[model samples]
Target chain A: MKNILIYLRLGLRNLLLYPMRTGLTVIGLGIGIAALTFLSAMNDGWLQNMKLNFVLTQMGHVQIHAQGFEQSRRISDYMGDTTLVDEALQSMQSMQGGIQAWSHRIRVSGLASAAGANASVLVSGIEPEREKDVSRLHTFMQQGTWLQPGDKRGVVLGDVLADRLSVGLGDKVVLMAASPDGDIASEVFRVRGLIHSGVMDVDNLLALIPLKMAQHWLHLGAGVTDVVIRTNSFAVVDSVVSNLQQRLSGKPLEILRWQEIDPMAEQWTMFAEIYTWVVLLVVIIVVLAEVLNTMLMSMHDRVREFGLMAALGTTQQQLFAMVVYETLVLVFIGGILGFLLGGAVSLYYGEYGLDLSQYATAFSFMYMSSVVYPELTFNGCARILVAAMLGAVLAGLYPAWKASRLNPAQAMREI
Target chain B: MSDHVLLEAGGLCKYYHSGGSDVAALDQVDFQLEKGAFTVLSGRSGSGKTTLLNMVGLLDTPDMGSLHIAGENVLALSLSERANFRLQRIGFVFQAYNLIRVLSARENIAYVLQLRGMKKTERLAIADHWLFEVGLDGLGNRRPDQLSGGQQQRVAVARALASKPALVLADEPTANLDSVHGESLMSLMRDLNDRCGMTFLIASHDPVAMAAAQQCVYMQDGRIVSVATP
Candidate 1:
C-alpha cells in the first residue's frame, strides 16, 4: 500500500511536468465521454417519451376484447355485456397492486362527412370522466370543449380530420357505418372539440363521442368494443397482465399488453438501445486511441527519467504499473468531469425541455413530440464510467511495455 | 570469493556494433575491489572506463564474463532477479543523469527502501538521516531542479549510499561539477570511505578524483594497464 501511494505520487508528479499536455489529453478524453453521455441521455428521454405518448396514451397498459374480434377487426363484432368480465375487472381493482386507471372504449372505423368534405377515420365512444384518468386525449383540446355526459349529440374531431373537412368547433358532421344487422346506420353530431394529439395518425384518423350516445346510435346495448386497463407503471405491466390472465382464465376474452399489441414500439426501443451501444463503442475506441497517443508521446520525452527509475531498481512490472496508474488518473478525472458536466446539461434540458414544437407537422405525423427532455440515469453513468476506465487501462499497454523494456545504461546515453 | 573482496569482475567482455565493426568496449577485463576501499578507474575518453563501470554495476550484460557481488554471482540471476538484486544490494551514482527530477532529494533516497517494502515512517527517518550525512540536512525536501549542481551531486551520493549496499558504482561522478565543488565532493566521499568504511568504485578522468583515491587503476583501449596506490 505504501509503495503504491509513493508510486502514485510519483506518477502524478511526472504528469505535472507537462501541465499543458496533460490538460489537453484529459480534455480530449473528457470530450469523448461528454458526447457519449449526452447522446445516451437524449436517447433515454426519447424512449420515455415514446412510451408515454405513442404507447401508453394510445394502447393503455392492457386491452381485453372478444376472442375473434382480432381476426375480423369489425366494429360490429363487439363484446357483449358479460357480467363475468365486469366482475373480474371490478375484483382486479381491489386485488391487483399495479392497477392504476382503466376505462372501457368502443372504437369503430367509418366514413364521416362535414359540410362539403368527407374522410375515413376511427371514432371512439368514451366515458368522459373515466377517459380523463386513462389517457391524455382530454388534455389535447386545440379548440372548443370535450364531450360531456349530458351532451348526447356532441362530437370531438381530431385536428387533422377537422382540417381536412374544413370544419371548426360547433360545426356539425354525419357519421356512417354498417351495423351488426348488415344495415347502413347514420347519425349527425355537433363538433364539440378539435384535438391535436401530437400524433399524426391519431390526429388524422381519430374522433370521440359519448359512450351512451354511441350505444344509442349503434344499438350495442351495454356492449363495449374493448376494455383498457392501465397499471401504475410500465415496469409492472407484465406482472399485471399475468395476474389478470390467471383471474380471467377460461373466459372468452383475449388480454394483451401494450408491447404485445404494439410491437413496433418495442422494436423501436430495442433498435435505439443497439444504436446507443454502437455509438458508445465508437466513442470508447476513439478515446483509447487518443489516450494512447498522448501516453506514447509522454514516454518518449521521459526516456532518461524511466532509465533513472530502472537504475534505482524499478522492475518491469512496476514500470508497467506506473504507466497504467498515470493513465488511470487521467481517465478517472476526465471521465468524472464528463459525467458531471453531461449530467448537468441533461438536467437543465430535463427541467426546461428542448423545444422542437415548431416542426409540428413533420413530428406529429410520426407520433413524436417537438418538446424533448433529455434523461440521465444511474445505470447509464455507471456503464460509461466502467468503459472509460477500461479504455484507459488498455491504452497503457504499449507504452508500459516500451518503458519496461528499456536498458538503463543505453537510455542515459542520450541525456 | 575472498571475504575481503566486495566486488569481482573476471574476464568480462562487452562488444559494441559500431562502424560495421565489433568494438570491444570491455575486453577480458578483470577487476576487483576490496571492502572499505575508495578506488578509481582513470582513463581518457573512449578508453572504456564507463563501460567497465556499467558492467560492474549490472546495468548491461557482458558477452562472456562472471560478476560476483559479496560472493554471489549476480550475472547468473534472471533479468528481473538482477533488477531486484540491484535494488537490494547495489547503488549507482551517475555523473550527468543522476537524480529523478520529479522527486525530492529525500524521496529519491527513500525510493529504493520503499521498493524493498520498508514502512513509510522508517523510510522517511532513514532518508532524513542520509540527507544529514550528505551535508543537506534541512534541504531534503528540495527537488533536483531546485538544488544547485553541487547539492544535487551530494544528494546523488547520499542516495547511492542510503541502501547501505555492498558496493557503490559511480560513472564519471565529478564530470559535471566545477573544480572546487568536485574537490569538496571528493573529500566528502574520501571521508566517508575512511571513517565509515564504505566501498566506492568510481570511474572518472578528474585529477582530483584520482588524487583522493587510495587505489587508482588506469585503463587504455578497453584493458587495464596499471594500478597505483597514491
Candidate 2:
C-alpha cells in the first residue's frame, strides 16, 4: 500500500507537469463514461416506464386463470369463485412483494358494429371500481365517463377503435361474440367513454363494459376468465407466481406472471437492457483506447527517466507497477468526473423529465408518454464503474509490459 | 569466493550493429578494481567509456565476458538476476545527472534505499546522512531541475552511495558541469571515498575528475591503452 501510494505520487507529479496532455486524455475518457451513464439511465427509465404504464396496467404482475384458458383463451374456460382465489392469493404475501391490486376480468374477442362500420376488438368485462384499482383504463378515458355499477348497458371504446367503427361516446353499438355454450350472442350497448391509451394495440382494439353486463351477455353465470393482479414490485414476480401456483394447486387454475402472460414485455425489457450495454461496451472500448494512449505517450516521454530508475536500483517490475498505478489514477479520476457530469444531466432530466414531444413524430418511440424520466440506479452506476475500472486496468497492461520490456542501457542512451 | 577485488571483469567484448557492420564497443577488455580504490576510465567521445560503465553497472551484458562482483559470478545470471544484482549490490550515476526530475533530492537518495526494501525512517535517515555527506544537507527537499548542475550531480552521488554498494559506476560525472562545480563534485566523491573507503569507477573526459582519481585507465578504440597512478 505504501509503495502504491508512492507510485501514485510519482504518477500525479508526472501528470501535473504535463497538465494539457493529461487534461485532454481525462476529458476524452470522461466523455466516453458520461455518454455511457446517460444512455444507461435513459434505458433504465424506459424499462421502468414500461413496467409502470404498460405491464402493470395491462398485463398486471400476475394473471391467474382456469387450467385450459392459458392455451385456448376462450370465454367458455371461465373460472368460478374469483373472490375465493384472490383471498387465497393474499394469504402468502411474503413472496408477492405484497399484492397492490387484483381485478377479475372476462375478456372475449368480438366484433363491434356502429354507424354502418365494423371492426374486430377485444371486449373486457370488468367491475369499474375494482378495475380502476388495478389498471390505467379508467385514467385513460379521454371522453365521457367510466362505468358506474348501476349502468348495465354502458361501454367504453378505445378512441381509435371507435374511430374505425365511425362511433363515439353516447353512440349505440352492437357487440357480437360466441357464448360459452357455443351459441351466437349479440348485445346493444351505449358507449360511455372513449379511451386513447397512446399504445397502438390498446388504442386500436379494446373496449370495456360492466362485469355483470358481460356475464349476462356471455352466459358466464357468475364466472371470470382471468384474475389480473398487481404487486408492489415487478422483481418478485417469479416468486409470486410460484407461491400462487402452489397455493392455487388442485383448483384447476394456471397462475401466470406478466412475463409468461406477455412474453413480449419481458423480451422488450431485456432488449432495452442489452441495447444499453452494447452502447456502453462501445464507449468503454473507446475509453480503454484513450487510457492506453495516455500511458503509452507517457512511457515514450519518460524512457530516460525509466532507465535512470532502473540503473538506480529500481527493477522493471516496480516500473511496471508504477504504470498500473498511473493508469488507475487517470481512469478513476476521469470516471468520477464523467459520472458527475453524466449524473447531473440524468438527475436533472429524471426530476423534470425529458420532453421528447418534438422528436416523437420523427422517432417511432415506445411507451405511453412522450416525456421520459431517466433513472440512475446504484446497481446500474456500479456496473458501469466496474466496467470502466476493468477496462482501464486492461488498457494499462500492454503499456506497462512495454515499459518493463525496455532495455535499460538503450533507454538510458535516449534523450 | 574470490580475492579482495570489488569488481573482476575479464574477456569483455561488445558490439553495436550500426548502419551495416558491427562496431566493437569493448574488445576483450580485462579489468579489475581492488576494494576502496577510486578509479576513472578516461576517454574521448566514441572511445567506449560509457559502454564500459554500463557493462560494469550491469545495465548491459557483454557479448563475451565473465564478471564477478563481491565474489559472485554474475555473467551467467539471468536477466532478472542481473537486475537483482544491480538493485542489491551496484549503484550508477549518469553523465546527465539522471536524478529523477519529479522526486526531491531527499526522495532521489531515499528511493535507492526504498528499492532495497529499507524502512521509510531508516531510508530517509540514511538519505539525510548521504545528503549532508555530499554537501546537500538542507537542499534535500529541492527537485533536480530546481537545483544547479553541481547540486544535481551531488544528489546523484548521494543516491548512488546511499545503498553502500560494493562498487559505484559514474559515467562522465562531470561532463555537464563547469570547472568550479566539476572540481567540487570530483572532490566530494574523493572525500566520500576517503572517509568511507567506498569503491568508485568513474568514466569521464573531464580533467578535473581524472585528476581527482587515484588511478586512471585510458581507453582508445575500445581497448585500454594505459593505466596511470597520479
Candidate 3:
C-alpha cells in the first residue's frame, strides 16, 4: 500500500508537469460526460411527460371490470353487484394513502345526431362529483362547464365529436344505443362542455353523460361496467392492484394497471429506456476514444521519463499502475466537472422547463407536453459516472501496457 | 570469485544489427571490481564503454556472458527477479543527469528508498544526509529544471549513493559538464567513495575522471586493451 501511494504520487506529479495537455484532456472528457448526462435528463423528462399525459387525461392508475368486459365491451358484461368492490375500496381508503380516488362508470358505443348530421361515439356514464376526483378529464375542458349531479339531460362531447355532429354547448343531440334488454333506447341531451384532449382517439369518439340517466335509459338498474382507480403514485399501482384482486377474489372480476389499458404507452416507455442506454453506450465510446488518444499522446511524449523511472528500480507492474493512477485522477476530476455542469443545467431547466412549443404538434402526437422539465435523478447521475470511469479504465489499459513493456535502454536512448 | 570481488563478468559479448549485418559492441570482455574500489572505464565514442556499463547495470542483456554481482548469478534471474535485484543491489548515474524532472532534489534521492518500502520520514532523512554529503544541503527542495546542470548532476549523484547499493555503475557521469563542474563532480565521487567505502565503476573518457580514479581500464573496439593504476 505504501509503494502504491508512492506510485500514485509520482503519477500525479507527472500529470502536473504538463498542465495544458492534462487540462485539455480533462475538459474533452468532461464535455462528453456532460452530453450524456444532459441527454439522459431529457429522456427522463420526455418519458415522465408521456406517462402523466396518458394516465391523467384518461386511464387511471388501475381499473376493475367484469371478467370479459375488456375484450367484449358488451353492455351485458357489466358487473351486476359492485358491493364487494365498494367494500374492498372502503377498507383500502381507510388504510390511508395508497388509493387516491376512484369512480364507477358505464361505458357503451353509441351514435350521435344533431342538425341532421351523425357520427359514431363511445359514451361514458359518469357521476360528475366522483369523476373529477379520479381523473383529470375535467381539467381539459375547452368550453362551457363540467356535468353537475342534478343536470340529468346534460352531456359533454369531445371537440372532434362535436364538430362531426355540428353541435356546440347548449345544442341538443340525440344519442342512440342498444340496451341489454334487447331494445334500442334513445335520448336527447344538451351539450354541456367540450373537451380538447390532445389524444386523437379520445377527441374524435367520446361523449360524457350523467350516470343516473344512462342507467335508466339502458335499463341497467344501478349496475356499473367498470371502476377506475387512481393511486397516489404510479409505483404503487401494482401493489394496489394485487390488494384489490385479493379482496375481490372469486367474484368474476379482473383487475388491471394503466399499462394494460394502453399498451402503446407501456411500449413507448420501454423504447425510451432502451434508447437512453444506447445513447449512453455511444457517449461512453466517444469518451473512451478521447481518453485513449490523450493517454497515448502523453505516454509517447514521456517515453524517456518512463525509461528513467524503470531504470530507477520501478518494476513493470509499478509503471503500469502509475499510468492507471494518472488516468484515474484525470477521469475522476472530469467526471465531477461533468456532473456539476450537467446537474446545474438540468436543475435550471427543471425549474423553468425547456420550452418545446415549436414542436408542439410532434409532442402532442406522442401524448407529451410541449414544455418538458428535465429531471436529473440520482440513479441517472450514478449510471453516467460509473460508465465514464469504466470507459476511462478501458482507455488507459493499452497505453499502460505499452509503457510497461518498454525496453529501458532503448527508451532512454531517445533524444 | 574472491569474497572481496563485488562484480565479475567473463566472455561478455554484445552484437547490434547495422546495415543488415551484426557488429560486435562488446567482444570477449572480462572484468572484475573489488569491494570499496573506485574504477574508470575510458574509451572513444562507440568503443562500448556505455554498452559495458549497461550490461553491468542490467539495462541490456549480452549475447553471451556470465555475470555475478555480490556473489549472486545475476544473468540467471528472471525479468522480475532481475528488477528486484537491481532495486536492492545496484545503482546507476547517467550522463544526462536523468533526474525525474517533476520531483524535488530530495524526492529524486528518496524515490529509490521509497520503492524499497521505507517510511517517508526515514527515507527523506537519508535523502537530506546524502544531499548534505554532496554539498546540496539547502537545494533539496528544488526541481531538476530549477537547478543548474552542475547542481542537477550533484543531485543525481546523491540519488545514486542514497540507496547504498552493492555496486554503483556510472556511464559518462561527467561528460555533460565543463571542466570546473567535471573536476568538482569527480572530486565529490572520490570523496564519497573513500568516506562511505562504496564500490564505484564509472565509464568516462574525461581526463579529470581518469585522474581521480584509483585504477583505469582503457578499451578499444569493445575490448579492454590495458589496465593501469592512475
Candidate 4:
C-alpha cells in the first residue's frame, strides 16, 4: 500500500504540473457524467409521470378489464364475470401476501352542459368509498366534497373544464349520451366538486361520476369495465396477475399490469439503460485517453529515468505496478471530483427543474409539464465512480508495459 | 569468499544486427571481480566496454554466456528474477547523472531503497548517510536541475550506493564532469572502496578513469588486449 501510494503521488504530481491538461480532461469526463445523469433523470421522470395515470395513482399493480372490451368501445363488447369478482376478491384477501386493495371502475365518453355551453368529456364512474382505498381521488378533490351514497346524480368536473365553461362548485350540469339500445338519454347532474390533476388533458376533459349511476344510465346494470388491484410493491404485480389469471382461468377475464397498459412507460425504462451505457462508454473512453496520454508522455520524457530505475534493481513487475498504482490514484481523485460536480448539478436541477417555459409556446409542445426534474440515486453514482477508477487503471497498462520493456544499456548510452 | 565473488562473466558475447549485417559488440570474454576491488574496463569507442558492463549488471543478456552475480547464474533466471537480482545486488551510476528532475536529491537516492522495499524512515536515513558521504549532506532537498554538475554527480553516486548493493557498475562516470569534480568523485570512490570494501567495475575510455583504477583491463576490437595491475 505504501509503495503504491508513493508511485501514485508521483503520477499525480506530474499531472498537476499541467493544470490545463488535467482540467480539460476532467471537464470532458464531467460532461459525460452530466449527460448520463440528466438523460437518465429525464427518462425516469417521464416514465414516472406517465405511470401517474396507471401505476401510482390509478392501477396499483394489476388491472382486470373485461375481455375483448379493450378491442371495442361499445357496451355490448363487455365480457366480465361478476360472479368471479367476489371469489377473486375473497381469494386475494385469504392468500398469503396477496393484493392490498381491489376495486372496479366504469368509463364513458359523452357531452356535458352547464348554463348553455356544452363540451365533450371522458367520465370515470368509480365506487367512491372503495375507490378512495385504491386511489387518492378523494384527497385530490380541489373543492367541495367527493361522491357520497346519498348524493345521487352528482358529478365532479376537472378544474380546467370548469374554467372553460366558466363554472364553479355547486353548479348544475346536464350530461347527454346514448344508452346501449341507441336511445338518447339526458340527465342533469349537480357539479358537487372540482379536481385539479396537473395533467393538461385530464384537467381539461375528465369527470368523475358514481359507478351505479353510470351502469344505470348506460343501461348496463350489474356490469363494470374491470377490477383494479393494488399491491404492496410493483414487483409483485406480475406474479399476482399470473396467479389471479390461473385461479380464474376458466372465466373470460384478462389481466393487465401498468407495463401492459402503457408500453410507453416500458420504452422510457429502456431509454435509461441505453443512456447509461452510452454515457459510460463515453466516460470510459475519455478517462482512458487522458491517463494513457499522460503516462505515455511521462514515460517517453523520462526514458533515462526509467532506465535508471531498471538499472537500480527495480523489477519489471515493480515498475509496472508503480505506473498502474499512479493511474488508479488519479482516477479515484478525478472520479470523485466529477461525481461531486455532477451531483451538485443534479441536486440543483432536481430541486428546481429546468424551466423551458420560454420555448413552451414556440416549440408547440404541451406534453411536458412544468419544469423537468432529474432523479438521482446514490447507487448509480457509486457504480459510475467505480467504473471510472477501473478505466483509469486499465488505461495505464500498455504504457506501463512499454516503459518496463525499455533496454537499460541503450537508455544509459543516450545520457 | 566464493559466495562473495560479486560479479562473474564467462564466454560472454554480444552481437547487434544493423543494416542486414551482424556487428560483434563484445566477443567471448571471461571475467570476475571479487568483493572490495576497484576494477576498470578501459577501451576506445566501440570496444564493447559498455556491453560488458551491461551484461555484468544484468541490464543486458549475452548471446552465449553464463553470468553469475552474488552466487546465482543470471542466464538461468527469468526476466523478473534478473531484475530483482540487479535491484538487490547492483548499483548503477551513469555519466549523465540520470537523476529524476522531479524528485529532490534525497528522494532520488531514497527511491532505489524504496524499490528495494525499504521503509521510508530507513531509506531516508540511508539517503542522508550517503549524501553526507558524497559531501552533500544538507543539499538533499534540492532537485537535480538546481544542483551544479559536481553536486548532481555526487547525488547520483549517493543514489547508486544508498542501498549498499554488492557491486557498482559505472559507465563513464566522469565523461560529463570537469577535472576538479572528476578527481573529487574518483577520490570519493577510492575512499568508499578502501573504507567500506565496496566493489566497483567502471566502463570508460577516459584517461582519468584508467589512471584512477586499482586494476585496468584494456579492450580492442571486442577482445581484451591486456590486464594491468596498479
Candidate maximizing TM-score: 2
What's the lDDT for all of these models?
0.85, 0.85, 0.88, 0.76
**Pairs of colliding residues, candidate 3:** none
Model 4, runs deviating above 4 Å = A30-57, A61-103, A107-123, A128-208, A217-223, A229-257, A357-368, A413-415, B1-4
Q: What lDDT is reached at residue B1 by model 1?
A: 79
Q: Any runs in candidate 1 off by more than 4 Å, and if so which?
A: A27-36, A65-89, A108-110, A113-118, A150-153, A170-190, A212-225, A250-254, A282-286
Here the TM-score of candidate 3's chain B is 0.98
Q: Chain A TM-score, candidate 2?
A: 0.94
Compose the digit string of candidate 1's lDDT tens values, residues A1-415. Answer: 3367877887788888999988888787778888888888888887888777765556787888887775577876788785676677678777865888788888887889988899997878898989888888888888999888899999998898999988888889999877667777899999999987878767888879998888778888988888888788889888878877898898788888876666677787797889778766866796698789989988998898888888888888899889988888888878877887888888899888989878867766445678889889887788788888888888988899999999989988865
Query: Tens digit of lDDT per residue, candidate 4, span A245-328?
Result: 887887776788767765655665576578767766766776797778876876777788778777876777777887787677
True contacts kept of each: 0.84, 0.63, 0.65, 0.75
Which docking band does candidate 3 fall into? Answer: medium
Error of 3 at B195 (Å): 2.1
For model 4, the docking class works out as medium
For B56-117, candidate 2 gives per-residue lDDT tens digits of 88888899988788888888787778887888888788888478888999999998788777
> Model 3 misses residue A141 by how many Å?
1.0
Q: What is the DockQ of each candidate?
A: 0.73, 0.70, 0.67, 0.56
| Per-residue lDDT of candidate 3, residues A47-125 (tens digit) | 9888888887767888899998888889988988888898899899899749888999999998999999999989899
lDDT comparing candidate 4 with the true structure: 0.76
lDDT of 3 by residue, B1-230 (tens): 99999999999999999999999999999999999999999989999998999889888899998999998888988777778888898888898947988889999999999999989899999999999999999999998999988888989889889999988888888888999999999999999999889899999999999999999999999999999997
Best by lDDT: 3
Which pairs clash (backbone N, Cα, C closer than 3 Å) in model 4? A313-B87
Off by over 4 Å in 2: A81-84, A93-97, A359-368
